[model samples]
Target: MQTKLRSRTITKPRSHHGKPAQSLVARRLPAKRPPTHPGEMLLEEFLKPLGISQSAFAVRLGISFPRLNEIIRGKRRVTPDTALRLAHVLGMSADFWLGLQQDWDLWHALRSKQAAAIARLEPLRHVS
Candidate 1:
């Protein structure tokens, strides 16, 4: 059976040190926004170093292979816990993961909001 995938939304905030707080995504601005999802980069980098398949990586991350696949495909959002776990497993800086996620969330949220706004404006265009 095909499972329904839900996009995850981050509500809480964290600190540079991984401390739980409010709006970490906001606190770390411009500089924190990465050029791309670090997880995707990390995943590729990690996979090369580990010499394992997606299933193996998923096992190491304590997530299902499909879920891991979703993350890689940009279909699923990465959570803080998952980011931390990745940092631990892949020997990457935890803050890097957090920054990537924060950046991804910010851009995705803004783009989505913009698209919705544009969509609303389409009907008005037809009426004009």
Candidate 2:
């Protein structure tokens, strides 16, 4: 009678071809939201620290009181010219105002782009 040999069993298996495995890390992308204008933030900071009335600040800034109020209320936008005027009256740098305006502009631009892209997508329809 011939003796039969049994194959050896391996406890730990390496790579298919015995090569080292590479490591990879996956990261989640940031979520997007409706962009906001920064005029509100700048106006809030200007008003909050001094505890001054909006009307008074507007007068001092040479801007219409109603317009200033609108800007504060987020109904009106902060234009570069308006920001410069505000900065001059508030003893802030023009650069600071410009930065805020720039941020607001970029945000609105992105928001518009997003809206356009969404408009191009197919709308959901209900089935009868």
Candidate 3:
């Protein structure tokens, strides 16, 4: 008599971040989608809802009006220190601001001309 074996499939659980892991093919060439800047989120979700003016919010955060304006316009990237300050004033986590900045920066950078140029560079070979 011979024993028969049954095949089984195992499924991976979704990530804690709420997004499902990309399939192998999807990972190679991710779909191109524009990411919303953290500044936009701040303006629409926070400032507008709270009826806060840019100047007033800037003063509350202890940052210059111009600096806050630049951020609101998505001209400048948020530094870790600035993230902490925003988080403190908004009663949000520093990681929340930092993560938004990071995601915004990375998406923009990846979609830039520099990223295309970098992709054309030859890869280094492994040393023996």
* Model 3, runs deviating above 4 Å: 1-30, 124-128
Query: Where does candidate 1 have its weakest 10-residue lDDT segment?
Result: 1-10
lDDT of 3 at 119: 54
Clashing pairs in 1: 13-23
By TM-score, the candidates rank as 3, 1, 2
lDDT of each: 0.65, 0.58, 0.71
Residues 38-78 of candidate 2 have per-residue lDDT tens digits of 55675566677778888888888888889888877777777
* Residue lDDT tens for model 3, 13-39: 223355543221111112366567778
Backbone clashes in model 2, listed as residue pairs? none
- Regions more than 4 Å wrong, model 2: 1-36, 113-128
TM-score of each: 0.56, 0.54, 0.69
**For residues 1-128, what per-residue lDDT tens digits would candidate 1 score against the true structure?**
11222553444433335655333243333444445775587667677677878898899889998988888777777788888888888787778787777777776664454644543342324554
Which candidate, 2 or 3, has the higher TM-score? 3
Candidates sorted by lDDT, descending order? 3, 1, 2
Clashing pairs in 3: none
